[model samples]
Target: MTTHRRLVLALQPDMLAICRLEPTAYIGNDVLNGNFVAITKTDEELSIICPQENMPEEAIYTKGWRCLRIEGPFSHDTSGILASVLAPLAEAHLSVFTATTFDTGHVLVKEENLNRAIQILTQTGHVVRSENKATVPYAIQ
Candidate 1:
């Protein structure tokens, strides 16, 4: 079996809800449903937002936020901290949203799952801090 090297990076404690939204120059913003959304351009290349189901299977979920950045001194294979953080939520049947920048990994859980996610992360030895509103820890989910 080939073992993949885990990237080392810092994570912050900020659980944000990944809201697939329709934000327009005309209407400003319209909140889409919980899971996924798709945007397409018309004949003139005009962008339009639509529910994800209507799009092709190849469509990917865009918009990454409502996540806590796992803080640094990161060495991927060190102790499996990353996996520790993710594993519990998966077992809890909560969906996780994630993205990786060159510097760190962002783990996004649902807004409703924010508290439980933080609790799980803390219980597992990973540190976390909610953004100022410290209670819920994210924008509208």
Candidate 2:
């Protein structure tokens, strides 16, 4: 039997920018000071995400991303939560860029895709709301 879990997601107001650099590229202090800054280096590329305005003028990036935050202080043992959320978006042909903090997961969908994403989430039984609204408790059923 398939079990449904209740999840509450809030749309964040800030616009996020993402940049890509060469594998060995070094980022300066300014970019690191963004409201949200992330850097990842793999064998092929170094990718970064930060508040849009903080992105260096010279950096090559794709901007205009809106964040949908999953309300969580989720325990370390929580499993399949991301999969549960991502599966529906994937099925709807929506693409997402995901970032995880210690306490929660932030999924960034292009600004144009935000509304469609919210509709899909709500249709799937997840509560989608703005960050400022009061949140109700989510239960895993």
Candidate 3:
């Protein structure tokens, strides 16, 4: 088995929501203004990840997810960054929703699982830091 390098991840401050809309549903301005938003449209659905407060009432959504952003502007050729983080979480039986930007990867775990997820990541040698004071107590040494 290959050993992936340890990484530092930043926990974003907002509580996000994941929404599913009809394949051709219109994405409004509310979602566009979020601190972090990801939208994807496929033949079956239009999926949106954004701050909970910005989600549209008509969309079917799951709320109270917290995002962990892998710190990087990694070169396109770089590999294993996300797997390293995800493998550990999967082993612990945690479900995650993931998204990737050109620069980094984001993992969203339900709010209730946030502390345990951070602990698991830290145990596996990854560092998770948060600017949100609410998460400060859970930061592992």
Q: Which one wins on lDDT? A: 3
Q: Pairing residues by index, what is the TM-score of model 1?
A: 0.46
Indicate whether candidate 2 or candidate 3 has the larger TM-score.
Answer: 3
- Rank list by TM-score: 3, 2, 1
Write candidate 1's Cα lDDT for 30-88 as tens digits: 32432322233434332322232332233334322345656555555465545666676
- Residue-by-residue lDDT tens digits, candidate 2, 1-141: 222676888877668898988888877777776445777789998888988877767678999997878889899799866776788889889989998889988888998877788777777788877767653232211
Span of 10 residues, lowest total lDDT, candidate 2: 132-141
Clashes of each: 10, 0, 0
Clashes of 3: 0
lDDT of 3 by residue, 37-139 (tens): 9999999999999999999789999999999998898999998988999998998999999999999999999999999999988888888888553333364
Q: Using Cα atoms with residue i matched to residue i, what is each candidate's TM-score against the true structure?
A: 0.46, 0.81, 0.91
Model 3 Cα shift for residue 27 (angstroms): 1.5
TM-score of 3: 0.91
Runs of candidate 3 with Cα error greater than 4 angstroms are: 132-141
Model 3 CA lDDT for position 111: 91
Please list all clashing residue pairs in model 2, or write none if there are none: none
